[model samples]
Target chain A: MKKFMNDPETFIEDSLKGFALAHADICDVTLNPSVVTRKSLRREKVGLVSGGGSGHEPMHSGFVGKGMLDAACPGQIFTSPTPDQMMEAARLVDTGAGVLFIVKNYSGDRMNFEMAAEMSENKVAMVVVDDDVAVEDSTHTTGRRGVAGTVIVEKLVGSLAESGANLEACVAFAERITGSIASMGVAFSSCTVPAAGRPTFQLADDEMEFGVGIHGEPGRRREKIAPTDEIVAMLLDSICEELKPSSGSEVLLLVNGLGSTPLSELYLVMNSASKWLNRREVAVARSLVGDYTTALEMAGISLTLCKLDEEMKIHWDAPVHTAALRW
Target chain B: MKKFMNDPETFIEDSLKGFALAHADICDVTLNPSVVTRKSLRREKVGLVSGGGSGHEPMHSGFVGKGMLDAACPGQIFTSPTPDQMMEAARLVDTGAGVLFIVKNYSGDRMNFEMAAEMSENKVAMVVVDDDVAVEDSTHTTGRRGVAGTVIVEKLVGSLAESGANLEACVAFAERITGSIASMGVAFSSCTVPAAGRPTFQLADDEMEFGVGIHGEPGRRREKIAPTDEIVAMLLDSICEELKPSSGSEVLLLVNGLGSTPLSELYLVMNSASKWLNRREVAVARSLVGDYTTALEMAGISLTLCKLDEEMKIHWDAPVHTAALRW
Candidate 1:
């Protein structure tokens, strides 16, 4: 595995060290429990917190800042963070308004965040996001696995929280987003975990994995590589089937790169997705194209579609300041 | 080649179409002679224009928005844009105030921008950036080749232009930035061009290309892969040799991913770079870590350091609202 790392055990810590320094203006890193919290705390505002495996960068950690996540707990690689980490993050970010935990639908993540919420002293609520329509069950998840659409949940729900929503309101909006969004991914190549020191899976040069999970989990099937439009159609078809937006409905389309995919290719995917939606008479009111949630160095792309209402659109357009995401 | 592209001939146009759509709020795309221009032009402000090949994304095109390049022309992958594209872009952005062209130090790019400036009707000035300290001369350049440092030049100079600096002042500030920054890169694997249908260069599984260029140009040497610290040391040594920064000097450190490298690994590199700079008593006043300029889907990282002065820091801290960069 050709990776720029020293020790696999220290990979997350080292990367976090750099991350803290690089974005010191916006967030601070607490080492023991590995919690990243916003530099300034807003009093009486719902504290939005989310986290998962470390491989999906710019997710929970990079999303910590004004108008986004209040804090984030990072686990090791594809492993879930301990309950203590989540508890610490909640404590750091929670003001008088209480805290909300945005947990992805992974067995490990769900369990850990649940434990944290149960033991927390502050009023805390949890919203499990299972936006991935690729599969009902996966290697690390029991139900549909949360994938790239978690970014949409974090951004929209975080915006609502930033607008002084209470903890219950934040939880309600997060659940609404989780139900409205769908995502599916395709992998051109598998990623190498630092500990594994080899690719998670192997594929011939002409093959591609469809509906793959974020951590290289098995997808629906494998087939010979197809044209860009066909590949995009496969992912979008699954997503659209789940969402099933009616004609004249507006939505936010996200073409997210699962590490190693170039921005140009992500844009290409976005272009094809826009065409597909237009043909179906679905208006794409908002679009995000780039690597927001990545799986190590995997070469793939994920398409996320969130059926948008006026409330969601207002929140989605709100200003956000974070490390990997800022506007 | 496993790329998300329909046809190699239309790769650039298709990607630009998606980019324009994705960032419609910030910029617009003009075809025929493709140019990405800011959505709202600033009348009487010196126009900043930059362009080159298409593969290095977010460089010339993604940088086109408020407080950055007023316009950018994107050519075919790894091919210089034609003079007409530059001329057209200059005409579109030059509102009363003269236009300033920021050209990277490449034979074709320099020649084309020069021709465009000579044939233009509006007042024009050009600043050629050659910040690469990898080698004095290379395959695509006459002197030192420009690399990731071009982003620094564009950001700092673009901020100056946005602050009502005239064409001559912008040119002077760009030159000052061009002279102060140094960059170098290394590639673990070569990227395939969509048109070529194969990798541009091959490396043994355990080997790496040191000092590689954005277009897969040969660097100083190739050797077996080294540890992250050693690699950071080597690249930093070359860059520091060129700059000879004093111990107490402050600099903006940028750890840029070529294309396919993960953000975690890039942060790991930044961690190592910070250590190296710290050992030398150099203060990192500003930091940027991620893919700013890329070479298609190449797996590599580059380090760029620009010595920062009080004025430069003020401009660098100014607001910028571009597709790839915003604050």
Candidate 2:
């Protein structure tokens, strides 16, 4: 697979060791339950938990720390963590306040997290994020699949939870924020699954996939690779087609890499996206561009736009400290 | 090239625009001089400036913020910036405490920064970083290439400068820190240069290059693709072979990707490197793992180790806010 891993079977677990060790002071990892919780939980704060399959680093697990997630329950590659894992995380991180689970919109993730919420002793609120405007449904998902906007939801809601917001308040904020965002991705090549030991899909030397899913699912359409300006305009047009922010409306822009796309390409895409927005008269108030959400070293970029209001802007700018996404 | 860009000739400038706009809250970007400096400079703090080719995002520019570099001058892809860029940066950033130029160990970078220092009005200390233990000399470089160790030098020296270290003091610490660091890299594939419109090098599907340079320069040797454990072992052994830390010495480990290498692979490399260190009884006091320094779309990881002492540890842990790194 051309990946730096000893064995495909052990990659996820061994990667967790690196994740835990990298942020040893901030997180305490439990292997059997497969949960990573904050080292010191707040005594009276609503606990925050987010999890998904592996491969998307700096998303769920890399984000467990102060002013962000209280715990992250990681599943295997692109697979949902079990109900037991989420229950264990809730039990470990819950204080006198309740617990909130940030689940993405995929069917497996929603099913597992819902059961985990009902099984937990503490009061729990589950907020499902479904912000990808790529499609209304996908091959691996029932509804619109949650994409890069999950990172925004976690940052905004985690900031509120850290500030002593109740479970309902965090859930409301998560829903509002999730509703305010949209994402669309462009892929230059398909990714390789470590276990599968082959490329997930094939592309010619001059082809690109538009609206590709994060898990290497087939995108909405394929076409000959175009110039950067054209590629960016198409992605932004798809996102804005759903979100439909009017002229002069303030927004937060997130240009994320699918995986193998380097920062140069990411920034170039951001540049074109910015030009795209500027021509439309939209005011970009805040921007977060990087490879926060990925598809296992796939060559692509996803453009996520978060329509921000005054209150949302405050929460978005709040301080956060994690293994990744620190500010 | 499969990169996202409107045009190869305009990619660097447009990408810089993305960079400036991304961190608009923190930086002031000038087009003619191609300088990116802090919006607000601290008077009496020694100014730190580092710059090189534009493709190395977050290295010279993503690092221009509080507690890191005061200004950065980005050249075209894989080319050294001119002296005028550095001179303009020094002119704007210097607040009467002079400036420190952190130049990588490339002939073009050294020559250009030296010329800029001679021409600038402000007192300057130029510290050259040559910690790549790959080979004594090779194409595109003389002596060892600076590689990823420049990030360490900037972080340490930049922190010291922010604390108001004088020019001489910054230079002394820079030399000491530079002497105590070593780096080595491994590449699975060569990157494509947009300007060149072709791949920099070629490799068989089953071959891997060890002791590679950042700019896709040839490595010391190429070997058959091996298991991840053996790959990490080779990289760590090369780095340790040069630095030769005592058994109990502590270090700050930096596992950097040469762009396109996903975080999944970066952490896997870190996982194996950490295991390698434990077997040798070395202490990892601090770890920074991500794509800090990168060649554009080069699929590889570079390991940098800075043997830390009491003072260096304190400075390393000190808070610094930048586009790529914030705490």
- Highest lDDT: which candidate? 1
Q: Write the per-residue lDDT of candidate 1 for residues A1-327, one digit (tens) a residue.
A: 798988888999999999988999999999998999999999999998999989998787999999889999999999999999999988988899999999899999999999999999988999999988988999998999988888999999889989888888888889889989999999999999899898999989999999899999989999899889888888888888889999999999999999999899889888999998899999999999999989988999999999999999999989999997887
Model 1: CA > 4 A from native: none
Best-matching candidate per DockQ: 1
Tens digit of per-residue lDDT, candidate 2, span B50-116: 9998777778888888888999999988999999999999988899999999999999999999999
DockQ of each: 0.81, 0.73
Across A20-39, the per-residue lDDT of candidate 2 in tens digits comes to 78889888888987999988
What clash count goes with each model?
A: 0, 0
Candidate 2's TM-score: 0.98
- Return the lDDT, model 2, position A322: 83
